[model samples]
Target: MSTVEASAAASPQTGLRVRVQKLGTALSNMVMPNIGAFIAWGLITALFIKAGWLQGIFPALRDPDGWVAKLGGWGAYDGAGIVGPMITYLLPILIGYTGGRMIHGNRGAVVGAIATIGVVTGADVPMFMGAMIMGPLGGWAMKKLDALWDGKIRPGFEMLVDNFSAGILGMILAIFGFFGIGPIVSSFTRAAGNAVDFLVNNDLLPLTSILIEPAKVLFLNNAINHGVLTPLGTTQALETGKSILFLLEANPGPGLGILLAYMAFGRGIARASAPGAAIIQFFGGIHEIYFPYVLMKPKLIIAAILGGMTGVFVNVLFGSGLRAPAAPGSIIAVYAQTASGSFLGVTLSVFGAAAVSFAVAALLLKTDRATDEPDLAAATAEMEAMKGKKSSVASALVGAGRGGTISTIVFACDAGMGSSAMGASVLRRKIQKAGFGDVTVTNSAISNLSDTYDLVVSHRDLTARARQKTPSAAHVSVEDFMGSPRYDEIVEQLKQANADSTPAPAAPATEDAPVGDADVLPVSAIVLNGTGSTAAQAIDEAGALLVAAGAVEPSYVGAMHEREGSVSTYMGNGLAIPHGTNEAKTAIRRTGISFVRYPQPIDWNGKPAEFVVGIAGAGNDHMALLTRIAHVFLDKDRVAQLRAATTAEEIQAVLNAGE
Candidate 1:
């Protein structure tokens, strides 16, 4: 039987293994993201707050009742203590994106959104602003803002930028903060929070409460203590509550609900989380324990409500002494004396409520793992980031584009025929919208895409081709044909690289090695798409020309084909260089430099190619010509530039950047 079938056949309690595996994977993904040490940062900050530590750092947010306490909360939490957390808010976005990838493949928007909510509200609201309200809204926007490359260049640039922006720069920020920048950053955060509060307190009271309250409770409350305030940790905290179960430390409503419900669905393993939550609330006074269990399945909102109503009923029926509102966490927080039937009565009420929640969860839900997809962590992070902000995957991809490297693109779906084409079109449109200038976007099957695009975006099973064919191109998978923010991000990267790649003026042409007739040779450039030809054949045709010209040396001609098979040195863009370097000097000489059209296409790199120019240079300083040649094919005006040049002189003129 298949692994999944066996999983189904095993007792529900058997899920403990899966749960442990998943938790391990989740923990691994949380910390081992393109982002740095995210899970460790989260757990650190969690310990800080759970321990009620850091009172020495900010005296105002400290617990007033216990002035000397060194653990738990800053001296002046809430609005006054809101500084350090907000700037790091993007971390939770990363977590949500990663988690979504973990659970649902590319269909991560919804849970990513929910995860965002969990992070934003897992804090002390009175001290911090609520950020969770943005989660669902962000998810909605991501769904609608889908963008694809669609054979366009601009979208690729955007994809490179948006997705990679934080990962690349966030590291820099982390370094800066580690080197004492964060301590000073508080001034800015304080000012920003004050401004937000001023606007809300004076003009939009109710609306502000709705927006800021939950976020403060979930995210910023003791964020610094919880480590979510760190650049990487905050990114994790933003998308998922690595520590929201805090208030639940005192409140039984939401905490007990998920625990009992788990017993119904995956009974045996559920106890791992459920019992842990119960014990923490009973004596540990830690509230964050319940968050992981509840946030595991967002549909647990029903359990939360059921637990809340039951807690309220038992409180009234037993006339339990309202002991400090029980930390809004569990009946365990209540004393045995002033309550209904003492501590025993409270446990009964708690179990009674738990039973109801378990029944609802077991009879109504089915548990399954998320789909398999590439870059799951990054996807989940972006999806989570989109939850509470105006950002979308498309926009974020565009934003991260500036840092991306050149990547080939492939559009893949079921037959490599229709959906691929559709995706290419959407991607192109989004790229145009992002304002990237003149980017190339196209579509072809994985079988035929041997050298065309660098990154393959597809939904189809190209496993055979992926393993057997070229592996340089990174494979990206998506479910819908609508769009991907990543394509635009790549376009942005291309733009930056182009802007940065102004070729240095031709290396003083070496007198040691000379073009026989700088004035007489005819130079031609050929451009081809969706065609394939073998490297060996192209070289053979070129060798025939050199042989006909009597210009080719035997040693030079033999080494050409040998090196071609080793690396295929034909970096495309309507160009191919198949030259073996001199033992000392690496100048390409045997250009057999004419364009050859192949009747049958062959894999060039990983995509299809129809036109190619073989390059084989000899001598020490012949590199100037090669450099010029590389630049020629990189631009979009390849055909026009080549056509205008009737002779070598004209070609050289066009090759020089317009003076």
Candidate 2:
């Protein structure tokens, strides 16, 4: 059965931490996806600015009377003038767009951009920090206004009202930004600059990591880099040709070290996934890839902190500094940004920080293995669950929710397809079967979630995000789309809610036999300590046992194979439910289930499975038994108990207990 990772419950003590993390994540979401823009800007600044590398490459470019003078003029004008405006104007607009989109969709984004223009124009420096703050706030206000006046507006005047309200709100916010927030922010920026100069003068640059590491993990790297560090570094670089401030948080070493540790010591899916993530992070300069890992185990923050401090210390000791910010935090970018005579120091800092982080992470992973193992296992199960779309009616019934019924349900995910599409199809079928034919079920990208849906379903990892997008809708979090028991619970609640008005459908003739009947799992059909190296082999073994008991025709095995080809039968938690399609109905001599337990897990598609249940039925005959089986698997410890059972009778007892 699929296991869910519930949303983390919040408490008063962690409130500050939670808020900081949320802010950081929001800022990161805005900036990280737009790394290409940052890269282009960084490259332009590095090559074309007054002290840029390009000037050194062709000395004639610096001579006004030389042939290359026009080239130098073009580079200088574009880099200093064009690039700064891009960051000043376009960056805030982009950030505003993302922040507004998060809260109130496209309309909010447009308003947010308009408001941000006020801040951008009011400040001498790029108004990224202001954009980050005002964009979402503006979007939120607009969203509330829209909701308050939702149906009050006349049908023919919706466009007029919406356009007027958004324009008015944007104008008000822009005026406030220019007149009020602008001067205050400018004063604060000056004060912050003074403080950084004090720290650098005292050689206390390493101390910045105390705040930087934690902030970076929260997704505030962009805000910190662009809002504070970049401006400070640019000033220092212009005067001294380099600034150590740029390397403080942009070093990829610490995150790379953490990922390497996970690749080496992490359990199950964590270990399996870390290697690929490490490559993307270390080479692609996408440090955001490691943020989730740090979030998963917050104590790892200590490792990042120490590593960052150590790297900064080394840079300070060697008088090492970068000429510009290293976009993407890749090692290559770091080296490219390094000034003359600083390569050795910068290289040493990277390795030293990585070593420190790896050592600490190794200890943490080892110490927390007991607790972390289950989460890793669950992640593995979730991965397997994403591969298929077949869900048994019985499994569907037991997995239903006890929540309030809704006429419209939307399945949301990061992307609109993949698991959400399959989940929508599964739930749609279950709803129809439960006599809720009039209810609408749909799938959508989480960003496109509408308030019109009565209920929204998403993966647990995305529950908070889904709520952020559609706060008005009831939300259900599921771990595995195909194997979630929540579906059964939801179906049950929906069925009851509509019972008075909607007529129940007649049961299929094949479901006449009760789920608990002894014939469903007769002792002769149970195989303990079974030997099979793959899912197909194990499934065939189970089918053989069923055939021996006169439960199915020999042709049923091929039918099961055909069904497996369409979609995996693996239901996760080391379990695979193998059954034939409706076309295989002629092969069923009797409706029964054959349970086979492998002594060791077998490869089922790319997933591992220890149990294979071969099912044969005429119409919906075996659905009741399948529901009971689903219940059995829902128990967290049931799979372990079944795996320990050495006898067919013991397995039989476990199956009966669920009934």
Candidate 3:
């Protein structure tokens, strides 16, 4: 989540901070997801450009004397011929598409792209910053015109009006971008470039990290990369064959160091997931993955700043630079982009930054693991909850009780394309399968959320921002986009509500009876007053119950442990639903759920758990059962009754009541 979304509830005095964060989120949203394109462009520029390793491999490439030179010259020729035009032509359109989509979806994207070409054509320098500004402005204008025309245009003239209006508006913006905005933006770019050049000449480049690290933590990495560094780096690379400006903000050393520290000293989910995150950060070139870790501990920004400064200082001392921008900020990409003589220097700078950051983070984490455990657990819970379910059927029912019916559902995130898009697609599929074909599902950036959506689903981290953006829309939060069990509960609720209001005819009974009392969860699976002090112990006892009932193999218990290691199974309200990982599917004999109640609450990571439910399913067949179980636990009355039950028979009766 962006700092703007995280600080939605901040005081009025922090308005500047909020605005800065919003700008960061918008700019980053435009560039981060498209890092792949940047990386591809970077590789092309680094491998085939005149100053690249191709010339080093074939020294005769620069000589105009022989046929060998002709073959070797192809690299530089292709680099300038193909890669240069890509940056000049395609980069602006990409920026425009992203910015326009953030404001008004596909229609806005079209107008934004059209308008951006005018700026790109008119300017000598790359018009990236101009695209960022004009793209959204054009999209917003189109959105306004669209809203104005809604319900007003005659049915037969709809296409005619839309086509004419869009064409006229686009043409006008293109002209304005060329004659009006282009000159002003170009002048500013020239001034900024001169200023940056002066800073680099004076050897004060490392000091820029004071601003860059904080802005990066707030999701301004993309804006800094494309809007500032890429333009400057391109100019420098053209003149000197390489530029240190590219590495200034794209370094992954600091983030990698912080993750390593977490792996060593952090508790709970942070420790467990840090190793995998480290590998992705260093190899995948995705620096955004570590933003949440920094956000969870804002004070850690100091470590990032110090580490970034150290890396820059080393680069300056070694006179190291890259042939092109290192997209995704991965170490491998950095090496790939490094100039021939700068490889050792760049490598040293990277590891140097990592070492500094690790030291600072380790000191902050300290030796007292117990003292930090609770905070780590809370952070882990918050992170997981962002991908977990946000709303219950009871809450949705309350909203529906007020005469509301969900006609539209919008999945929102910091950027529209990442998790929200995936979640929206998955939910749309499920909604269609559940027969709610009339309900429209879409995805958008959190900033673009509007009251038109009847339901807004987003990460829990963005719930406050979502509510602020679309107060009338019912909100749902989830941690994982692809595997949220909450979608099933939501579908069932909507189906039931639709059935109640539509007066549909009763359908014939089907063989699949929704996994209720008739199918599984007999009294034998219930264990009351179970003996367990820790979450793992409680889960083990529950899994044993499932194993004894022939619901799963003993390997299923290890799978449960493995899943918990990745993310806590704690479902809030003193309940935990432990299940095996996907890899453990072979251990399942059938779909079954076993419940064990611990009279004494056990610490499920940082959350307290009094009830442990072990789940084993052959496939997705248990999803319905999981949904029913969620509903049962979500109800205060049902949970209270289950807690008060004395015997396995009484627990069974409560479970049956929930069904």
Cα RMSD for candidate 1? 21.8
Clashes of each: 135, 13, 8
Superior candidate under lDDT, 1 versus 2 = 2
What lDDT tens digits, residue by residue, belong to model 1 across residues 148-263?
Answer: 33344575486674455323333332343333333343344456445534643454322322322223223322222222222222332333322111222233444555555554
Name the better of 2 and 3 by lDDT. 3
Which of the numbered candidates is closest to the native, going by highest lDDT?
3
lDDT of 1 at 314: 53
User: Which residue segments of model 1 deviate by more than 4 Å?
Assistant: 1-48, 55-530, 533-558, 565-575, 580-592, 596-611, 616-659
Alpha carbon lDDT at 48, candidate 2 = 57
TM-score of each: 0.26, 0.51, 0.55
TM-score of 2: 0.51
lDDT leaderboard ranking: 3, 2, 1
TM-score winner between candidates 2 and 3: 3
Q: What root-mean-square deviation over C-alphas does model 2 reach?
A: 19.7
Superposition error at 105 for model 2 (Å): 3.0
The Cα error of candidate 1 at residue 142, in Å, is 14
lDDT of each: 0.40, 0.69, 0.71
